[model samples]
Target chain A: MPIAITDPDDPRIEPYRAVRERDLVGRQHRFIAEGEVVLRVLLKQPRFEIESLLLAENRLDGLSDALEDLPPDVPVYTANRQVMDAIVGFPIHRGILAVARRAPLLPLEEFLTALPEDALVVGLVGLANHDNVGGIFRNAAAFGAQGVLLDHESCDPLYRKAIRVSVGGALVVPFTRAPSAEAMVQALQAASFEIIALSPAGSEILSRVKPARRTALLLGAEGPGLPRELLARSRTVSIPMSGGFDSLNVATTSGIALHHLTSQKDEKPLPR
Target chain B: MPIAITDPDDPRIEPYRAVRERDLVGRQHRFIAEGEVVLRVLLKQPRFEIESLLLAENRLDGLSDALEDLPPDVPVYTANRQVMDAIVGFPIHRGILAVARRAPLLPLEEFLTALPEDALVVGLVGLANHDNVGGIFRNAAAFGAQGVLLDHESCDPLYRKAIRVSVGGALVVPFTRAPSAEAMVQALQAASFEIIALSPAGSEILSRVKPARRTALLLGAEGPGLPRELLARSRTVSIPMSGGFDSLNVATTSGIALHHLTSQKDEKPLPR
Candidate 1:
């Protein structure tokens, strides 16, 4: 199915091109992880549905070894450097990019019920940056947080930049878009899980987080941290910072908090 | 005094032009943080020395107020949009662009001794992205981390992108460039500060960290965490995570770890 495009204005590349238009960029509800290195990482996922792959005449990597799962039928469009530059609107060094459709949103109930008896669902609220979200996922995957839940205003977790930032951790981590903060909080409470809001205005320190059967950390963006309302609704657990400097990125906050909550089973409790 | 040039190739603006180079573009050490908005931030710092300023004809916010500082001494150049655009490689937004010499690197001793006793110093290892570094500073400032210190491999804390990502915190938070990790570790030990390395490899949880007289939470870049030698020299305290997920980002880890260590002052022993 490989289709050659002598013209950069080919209609076949609308979805990919639309990624750059301001309005469609972040709000796509899907991600465009348009790079060779990252697409290879996505290929590892069983559910990866690569819509299209555009590459230059000179092959990028060990395309033979990296993309074995491609059933010969998938399109591997070939073009010269100039054509690719025109097509992608930028010179992508690695020279191959695949437009990956967002995986179907996982069901919350299934994810909720799937957690072990004790679980900590790290919830991301207002985490708008795709790269930040992806980085958080990467850290989340590395540290073994049970799952990540995006709040109402969050950037799409599966967005392309996030995929690249997470270095493909976006594929492995079990994350779902949670409902409104109120609804998500209620659900966590209904399930008998404690909702620990990681905040700068926390009443207790993060290490002092006394885990119950389950815990869910509510993370807001780095600047305007968890909205005041979200903080008010949940039990606040602050990470005491000794440096006089203000603020850490939300992704970074989520990572430390996730690690803190997860480590409870093995050692002495940290400060709350 | 003001100087105006219609040519973008004018050697007079070499400092500004050098900023456009690949390694230095959008960088802290050389990037010219143009605009009244960004320059106003630079003016507050005793550190950011103004090299030159190009002002567009119109009156701007803070511009009306800064005339006193502009005395007959400083260079204030002027050009309309078209002319300024010709001189600058890109459209000069914010009407005003100030070219300032980067603050000289403060010695580790100067940064450490300048702080009041028991001050929190954030030592970063291998965190490269300017934005991430900037965001780390923002969070560090928010949580009152005393000062941020970058080891040799870290990005410059003053880059334009870092400044933007920090939301201006880069201009405010006090930071030092300590190029040697070993030297930094030695400095901390000399300060009688206990360096707590945050990681997932250890059994000790974050809550297990006993509040010390002076603490430095040494953080490494994501993916490859702190080197074994560094970890070996420091007390290892980890944030617990559910089995099989990845760890948190170095900046976020610093935030939570700093929060964990800073929260309570009670020396009461916790129950095992």
Candidate 2:
């Protein structure tokens, strides 16, 4: 059975207040998930724990199946559309919201060691846009990338909008942050991963590159792509694009690269 | 020479007022182009005529090169940040805007006849999201797709947000709208185009398919993909994704599909 709250100020639904404003200031290790699809994704992922749910009164019947699987301790609260709008400080047409605690950040070394020999992953550097980060995660999951490695400068994948934009991919995909892009490259190299830097000025075309046993594709922000030094060190590969138009949205680039790298069979033997 | 406008409500700038509100209603035949990059693109394209430009006073010096090439009759108006923001009914940090007349829509038959012997193009059906449409156009241009064809249900590609999201690809790419998706298929088939419908349930894997001399890739909205009848009629192809995750952002899907199709050498000879 679900709890019914009448007032927008009900302390039980406090976390859902002024979500738009709270999105700017940090959520203190908590993140909000919106829409029915995302909530279903959140419930399925064992990595994160659901704190609570606030749904429009009309949404309860539709969400019965998802609610049935929820752990009994998790509170499900319902409010009328008026109160729901007042609490969130905006009109949320989806009328589904949940607050979940973020999983503890795993150490980079532990994460690297856990990867299977035949692994493919994505490394993001200086990508500040939430939509890009989210899109990359969505692609990572679609293409079977083992995990996402983010440099400290990259924005949080669990940010509300990022999670929403990802279509719940942020919840499904495993990710961890590194100190810097250089540090990430060093760690990946130590793990015997072949780092492929994607850039417009790359030396090799993407289609021709054969994947190693463990491959990592590194992506950078749009204007200032991966650092010049990083590109020089790694096996840089470029996607052949139309003449005079070099730009592809970074997230879109990831999708194309991931598809090529993952779809191709590893032709070369593993380096000892 | 540039004209200076001191007031937000000046009759000369009436077309630029309350841009956010005006975007919801139709803009007659005019479309708004925001940001310096889009402004540059709008100026370069001869297909569309520039009616006027509204910019913050500070932007005048930076745009001198582009402005120099402008037609003598096209008006350029400058206003302070305060007046510009007030006129637009919102804060536009880009501080640059332009209203340009939309190019006349060419008939589907005419557009099909104009394609080169080995042309590549994108066909959109039921894609209403501006961002997705914009992103698809961006991909289409990056991959050297000669043009875009839209079904009647598709939203206007010239919508301001779509143009901005496309990174100005909307301005660069030549597009035409058809009366219906079925009509588009009939016209494309008559022109001997190998129409490839992108859907998750597609019979052929994308990587394995050999494109023809003239290929047209069809994309539909996310939730409800291309109509089953169209999919049955076309050479339907699917991107091989990881198990349990079938969704890809429509734009990202276009990027991956376009890159693969364009990069591959067309192995089939043209049919008589």
Stretches off by above 4 angstroms in model 2 are A266-272, B266-272
lDDT string for model 1 (B104-164, tens) is 7678877787776656678888888786687777667666667787888998776766776
Count of clashing residue pairs in every prediction: 53, 0
Residue B185, candidate 1: C-alpha displacement in angstroms? 4.0
Question: TM-score per candidate, in order?
Answer: 0.73, 0.97
Model 1's chain B TM-score? 0.79
Error in Å for residue B18 of model 1: 8.0
Residue B98 in candidate 2, Cα distance off native in Å: 1.4
lDDT, each prediction: 0.69, 0.90
Candidate 2 at residue A253, lDDT?
97
> Docking category for candidate 1?
acceptable
